[model samples]
Target: MAERPRVWVSQPLFADIVGRLGEHFEVSATETVVQHAPDAVAAALREADGALVTLNDAIGAAQVAGAGRLRAIANVGVGYNNLDLPALSAAGILATNTPDVLTETTADFGFALMMATARRITEAERWLREGHWRQWSFESLLGGDIHGATLGILGMGRIGRGIARRASGFGMRVLYHNRSRLPEAVEREHAAQYVGFEALFERADHLVLVLPYAPEHHHLVDAVALARLRPHATLTNIARGGLIDEDALADALGAGRLAAAGLDVFEGEPAINPRLLALRNVVLTPHIASGSLATRRAMVALAVDNLIAALGYGPDAGRPPSPLNADALTHARKRGA
Candidate 1:
């Protein structure tokens, strides 16, 4: 008998969906959602043939350095920043992510977060719960209107376009800034106008960020950019936490420079900034943008499919869907040949 290839599941995901991997390979999955230490991740990959990971697992260069058998890493979320692409590519490891499946779900959450921030929904709930309902006067808890407002989108990706289409119902003029201009037909389809990066900050009454985070975009929305926003404008971030400077955002909220802000992701997640916590104007949520039951399940299913295909199993064997590093396989074949 031949030894079966082994795979590791970095976190505890849906059992039924993860069990699919066990059909084709030996599976070692964590029992709990844990923040794995770098060395621990390295050790697991050192033995496993592939891994199913979430954002919680940070697989960097050091981790892949000793991963002699690691052929693939299927990330459950759309973002692959948690996995070091350069390191994985150099090590001939295929990296795949679950995208498209969560786009609409994430857009829904982004809009909901924005509306909550603009209307002070979360703040009002806290106030009412705290016995402040007695003070609910006609003029109390004034919030900005969503209808007929300028909705600015920082990234014009699939999620951002979904948001733009949703905005059409509210009759908002959509302005967007992306790395490149979307096609004219696409711009027309969503009724979104392409604007310069600074114009997006200046003109939008409510700005929603759906941009993917990268090293160059760290703290992209600092005090300087926040200052450009109309004093009454609201900002929503369903993207990466590192996009905005928490200190700058807290200062803006505290000093009344901005109307309000909604944040789903944070720079230091699970451990929030105390300064932002103190402010009432900000709407804060633990990262759950793509957290609907159906969407999460679909994401897991897609990741499982990606992993199976990546490991040379399933119908799509040797061609994993949504591969970030398919070239790694070519590198492997060249070396093997």
Candidate 2:
């Protein structure tokens, strides 16, 4: 009998969901959520036929070059910046990411973060917890209102569209900037108006970033762009942390140039910028934007399905979540033939 293909789970996911992988392949899952070293990741790929990874486990050409047996990788999140696509394509390694699964949940979190930042919900809670209710007065913690505000979105993907749909309920004038404008029907459904990038920064009362991360876009929101924002405007990022320059943002927040920020992702996550930590006006959360129990479980399940299908074992073989690196699957089949 032919040997079963081996699959490595880079992080601890829902056990039951991960167990599904075991039925199709020999599964090896880490017991804890580990910050895997590059060497460790490369070592695992060397022995495995496929890998199930999250954003934290970055796989590139350097890592995959020597991974002769590695044919597939299933990423548990929507973003694939963690995977070097060009590198993966060069190596003919199929990669898949869980996209639609986390869209609504992440959009929900983005909107909530905007509300929290604009309303000073987290900051006021901290003050109350420290027994500063005695200092409370009508004007003590006044915050900008979310209703009747101009809301700008940086990316108009699925999550961005979802946010725009929610914005209509609050009567916000929705403006968005994307690499390309959405279709007229899509724009009508979301009630989002396309605006130039600079215009988005200048006009919005509340700005929410949902842009996909890319190398060229690192620190895309720099001091100059932040300067374009109205002093009373609030910024909320549920996207990648590298989008904003932390020092510039901190400087803006400290000088009262920007009202406040709500951040769910950071540039150097797990280790946030010290400048952001010291600000009471900012709301910081560990990267848990797609962390609802149902959504996370669904993500793991989808990733597992992707891994199974990518390895040509499941009912959906040859048709993974994303038709990523079809050339790789063709190469694998040719080798098998």
Candidate 3:
């Protein structure tokens, strides 16, 4: 009999999606839903051949160093900051993320959040719910407009392109800044202008953050960057939290240095900076940008597929939709390293 591969699921994801993994591997999962501490996660990884994790689980290099049998880690979200890439590479392990399936869905959420922030949707709803809507006034809920405004996107990847495509219908001028310039044809098709980061912060009436999180990208939108924006601008972040500084953002909002903000991710998961929460100008969500019923299910399905493939079962097992550390395979084979 073939010995079933030992797999650990770090979180309680979609039940059906998790159950499917059981068919191909010996799966161990937590019964109750909770964020596992790094020590707990490390302990679990020590006994498993591979893991299915969420962004909340921080799998650092030290943790992976102890996992002698660890081969692959299938992340439930598009972001992979939770997993230490250098550590994973050093350990010769594969890391996969569910990317393409969530692109359009996440972009839709980014647009919606931006609009909600710009138009004061959440604040207005709260005003009504608190029975403060006794009478109507001309400037009662005055907010910024989306049409004819400039939309600034920090990242020029798949999701950023999706956001750019949506700008046309709103009659927005899209400006983007990426590490490398996208093709001239793509820019012409989307009517997006590739600009410098400084120009993006200055001219954009609406700024959206979609850049990947890295140590170098930590606090990319610091207080200085926030100060550079127009006072009437709206800031939206659907990307990883570390891309912006929450305290700096709150300070800007408090001082009226910035108009409003929509945040789907934060520097820390489950715990948001209290300063941002105290302000009415900021709209906050619990990192569910790719959380549409259909999209989230698809994300889980792809993750399940990755786990199955990496476990040497499915036809495409070991071939993930997106592998963060694809170079690890080559390094592992070199000198049998």
Candidate 4:
């Protein structure tokens, strides 16, 4: 009998779903759930045919070079920044990310964060907890209204489109900006207006950043961009960190250049800018936008499918659901390497 493909799961995940992989492939999972440093992941890949990793695992070219048997990496998040694609492709390795599974869940949190920021929920709670809510006054915790407001979305991708769809129910005028505008038919269907970046900044009553993080997109929301926003505008970012300049954003919120902000991911995660922490107008949450138990489980499950499939084992072997570098498949087939 042919040997079973070997998979090393970087972190402990849904046991039952992981067990499914074991039925068709030999699976080795970390006993404890923690981020594996790049070196550790590379070491495991030296012997593994494939691996299932989360955003915490950093799999790069050097690691891939050492991984002679490694053919695929299954990332459990919608974001593949954790995986170095150029490096992986150079090594003739396939990489896949779980995208669709977390869209709705992350969108739900994005909308909720926007509401909390606009309503001053976190700050007011802290004030109440600090014994500052002595009397009720109409002017005391004043915040902007959301109803009948203009909602501008950057990046008209799946999650951005989801946010725009929700805006319709809120009676908001949906405006979207992307690399190239969405089709006129899509705009008509979603009741959205296609606008330029300048117009989105100038007009949105509430702005949500839902763009992907890329080299060119680093610090996309900088001091100058913040200046274009009205003082009453609210900002919500459910995208990657580095998309916004943490210091510049804190300054805007601190000086009242912008009304309030909701942040889930930061430029340097787990360690946020101390300035943002001191501000009263920001709603901060650990990076858990797609962290609902079910959604997270589904993400892991999908990633497992990717790993097993790419390894040419299991029910859907060789049939990865979402291959990030699709060209790799043709290369894998042509060279037969």
What overall lDDT, based on C-alpha atoms, would model 4 receive against the true structure? 0.88
Candidate 1 residue 138 Cα shift, in angstroms, is: 2.1
Better of 1 and 3 by TM-score: 1
- Using lDDT as the yardstick, the better of models 1 and 2 is 1
Error of 4 at 307 (Å): 1.4
lDDT of 1 by residue, 1-337 (tens): 8888899999999999899998899999999888999899989989999999999899988998888888999999999789889888878899999999999999999999999999999999999999998878998999999999999999999999999999999999999999999999999999999999999999999999999999999999999999999989999999999999999999998999999999999998988999999999999999999999999999999999999999999999988889998778877776567
Reference-based TM-score of each model: 0.99, 0.97, 0.96, 0.96
Q: Candidate 4, which ten residues in sequence have the lowest lDDT sum?
A: 328-337
Could you give candidate 3's per-residue lDDT for residues 166-203 as a string of tens digits?
99999999999999999999999989999999999999
> If both were scored by TM-score, which would come out higher, candidate 2 or candidate 4?
2
Candidate 2 structure quality by residue, lDDT tens digits, 120-143: 999999999999999778899889
* Segments in model 2 whose C-alpha atoms lie over 4 Å from true places: 330-337
lDDT of each: 0.94, 0.91, 0.89, 0.88
Query: Candidate 3: TM-score?
Result: 0.96
The residue pairs in collision within model 4 are none
Candidate 3: clashing pairs of residues = 309-317, 309-318, 310-318
Tell me the spans in candidate 1 whose CA falls farther than 4 Å from its real position: none
The count of residue-pair clashes in candidate 2 stands at 0
State the lDDT of candidate 4 residue by residue for 1-337, as single tens digits. 9988788888888898888788777888898977667687778999988888888788888777788778889999998888888878767789999999899888888888998989999989998999987786878899888889999999989999888888888899999999988888989878999888989999999999999999999999999999999999999999998899889998898898999999999988778899988888899999989989999989988988888788887677778988998776665666464
